[model samples]
Target: MAQKDPVLALDNQICFALYALNRAVTARYRPLLAELELTYPQYLVMLVLWEQGAGAESARVSDVGARLRLDSGTLTPLLKRLEERGLLLRQRQADDERVVRLLPTEAGWQLQEKARQVPARLMCGLGVEPQRLMALQQELRSLLAVLEGSAPSD
Candidate 1:
């Protein structure tokens, strides 16, 4: 009988480590964002949407889902909740009815100004230099890409 490799055990998985770390990191953002009535996931969606601009904050549901590492099943209800809160609008694209676009409302963009302080607050709490943090981010991103099988090939 072949013995299992210790390194291949679930306890040694990089994904599990990241999962724990991700939860811990997100915990830091919770109370800080309560003032804006935003949850970590909602704030992350808003961050991505803000980059897309006011009128067309979300190019496609798939795009946002991919960026956030979320599935449509999850995004669908989240988008609906956001729409209900009047922070964003979701509708099918004219060219492709199957594709939905997410557009932030005037109220949504205003939320970005309040969120601007989150990064600074997080940095202070971590007590790390910006360069160190950037390096860590790059490493973590690479780890995520590898786990998702999205890393670019040479």
Candidate 2:
């Protein structure tokens, strides 16, 4: 039997580090989000909505999906659950029957206040300097853009 290459080991893989870190971060968020009755994905969706400026809050379902890099198959069910929880509303556009728009409910808007401190709390828990986190986030986004841009050619 051939020995496995050291370069192929799990501990040496960047993907493994990313996967483990993602899980750890999500685990850290679990308890924090539970207090607001939100799952991590739900909180992400809410973040997008909350960031939309005044009078421009509603977004097409496709738009939301695009922003989150999600597809209807995955996003639809999450939207439905949020709607059921009275956190958001999904409606078909009057002019475009095929277009579905997502609008946060008053409750959802109210919940934003409750969630305002989440980032700070998460940062404190992470024990990373804000500047370092921002730089790392920028690097990750750059990596993501490169990966996404290369996909069709692959």
lDDT of 1 at 144: 71
The C-alpha lDDT values of all candidates are 0.85, 0.90
lDDT tens digits, residue span 79-146, model 1: 89888989988989988899998888888888889989999998898777989989999988897778
Q: CA lDDT of 35 in candidate 1?
A: 84
Estimate the TM-score of every prediction. Answer: 0.81, 0.94
lDDT of 1: 0.85
Per-residue alpha-carbon lDDT of candidate 2 for residues 1-154, written as tens digits (9 for 90 to 100): 4789898899999999999999998999988999899999999898888788448847888887888998999899999999999998899999989999889999999999999988889999998899998999999999999988896677
Q: What is the lDDT of residue 72 in candidate 2?
A: 93
After superposition of all CA atoms, the RMSD between model 1 and the true structure is 3.6
Q: Candidate 2's C-alpha lDDT?
A: 0.90
Report the Cα lDDT for residue 20, model 2: 99
| Stretch of 10 with least lDDT, candidate 1 | 52-61
